[model samples]
Target: MKTLQSTTFKAIADDTRLRVVNLFVTSREPLCVCEIVDALRLPQYQVSKHLTILKNAGLIIVEKDGTWGYHYLNENNPLNKMLFTFLKKYLVGEVFDDDIKRLEMRLLLREEGRCVVGFVDEKDLLIKIKEKKQELLVKE
Candidate 1:
């Protein structure tokens, strides 16, 4: 018999899930799976697997828009909100810091506050950032 306590803890027991939670903690914007994969430097399937576990545990929620599904931490429950605050305070390290940096870079691809491009690999991300900068300059 898995209670909510056990299920919630179990969902975050894995290192990958912890990382995913950390991303959600840091991000104010909901992210799509591909953005998470690119930020975590992991395969989409691997990230998606952890995402499913988090979803099932009620730690996060997904809002689907057409083919893209944006995910964010679920804080509707008081316990989950408290857990989110705790994780935001405690989950730290070079690895997590790197994920945030990569995620910030990935977020540059968002258009009008939504993810427009999918899976911008690290190399292409740099080029895309440069292009975006040029576009901004042109608009200015």
Candidate 2:
């Protein structure tokens, strides 16, 4: 049985890992690693590293669909339930809020009825960001 005695605490001990947990908790939807990178504005490798730690710690679960993998909170674990409850009630800081906001924006990039634009490189993201900005400017 997975226990919170070590891995769970270690997983969330890092600020970035904790933020990633909060992202999953708040969204209540499995998120892809690319979406996480875009939302946190962190490098892909860094986010993937955090994700691996979380997965190893049993704090998150991965679901694979073809080439895409989505990460979700391991809600079935009792320890995770307690931790998520605490986080949902108390972790209302600006950084988490900002992640959620960016996550919402990232969702907007989806091609309607599909998961996000699906794992674009940094260059692609930059181009998309510029296009989005232009669209906003035209609308305003």
Candidate 3:
């Protein structure tokens, strides 16, 4: 599923996407689309659109419980696995500031829910990056 892998990378390439992923990664609870949008201070439609992209890339999953759509990281996805490995090796030491981490934590807690962390696999990371680049091209 080269296409899947590519889409996954694309989803992660944007700063917004990365932040969304980070929120999912560190969140202690699941979050709904509204919660995510409010947490990120993004428009509802934009957040939904991004979430849709992430879901398509297999980086995230939506669980429907009644009228709520909870988004969580999909650790079983191959692309996410790779992202985790890469982050552990190269990104962990970057030292995110307390404010940023707190912001992330606060965002995660917005809807009073729980989320599961998912790892990005190797192939998916590449695919995601490629897709992100393509998106940039389209914007240009």
Candidate 4:
């Protein structure tokens, strides 16, 4: 168990991994890889790399829905739950504030509360999101 704890600690040691965990803590729903990419403004490859580490460390679990894979904190794991609760309080301010804000925006683009906007490029997703926001504004 000590080895597992060490691996978990090592997984979250990186700034990006910590930010990802913090994002999960703040989110009301599980987030897909594309949504994570959009929120972080990081390449999918980088996000995937961090996700793999977190998964290997037993910090996260992934679920497949159709073509998209959604990631969530490993709630079933006692250690993960404990760590996530700690993260929820510990990581407040600039450490992950911007990423959380961006995640909120990314979630707004969801269609029927599901992550359907899979973007190969961040710019394309931004354009679609802008159009969707304008449509909502016009409707109001």
| Model 1 agreement with the true structure over 1-140: per-residue lDDT tens digits | 76888889999999899989999998867999999999999998999888998998999999999889899999898998888899898998998999999999999888899988888879889999999999989999
Global fold similarity of model 4 (TM-score): 0.85
TM-score to native of every candidate shown:
0.95, 0.79, 0.59, 0.85
lDDT of 3 by residue, 22-129 (tens): 666655346676556545656678878888888887777789976668887778867677775564344332232332354454443222234332222333535644
CA lDDT scores, all candidates in order? 0.91, 0.81, 0.60, 0.84
Candidate 2 C-alpha lDDT tens digits along 1-140: 76456767878899999889889888888888888887888888999999999999888899986766789888887877988888887779999999888887776666543464666554566678678678878989
- Pairs clashing within candidate 2: none
1-140: candidate 4 lDDT, tens digit per residue: 47777888899899888889888998847889998887887888999999998998888899999989989888898888888888888887785899887888778788888886775355565777789989889989
Candidate with more favorable, higher TM-score: 1 or 4: 1
Model 3 stretches astray by more than 4 angstroms: 1-4, 85-140
Candidate ordering by lDDT (highest first): 1, 4, 2, 3
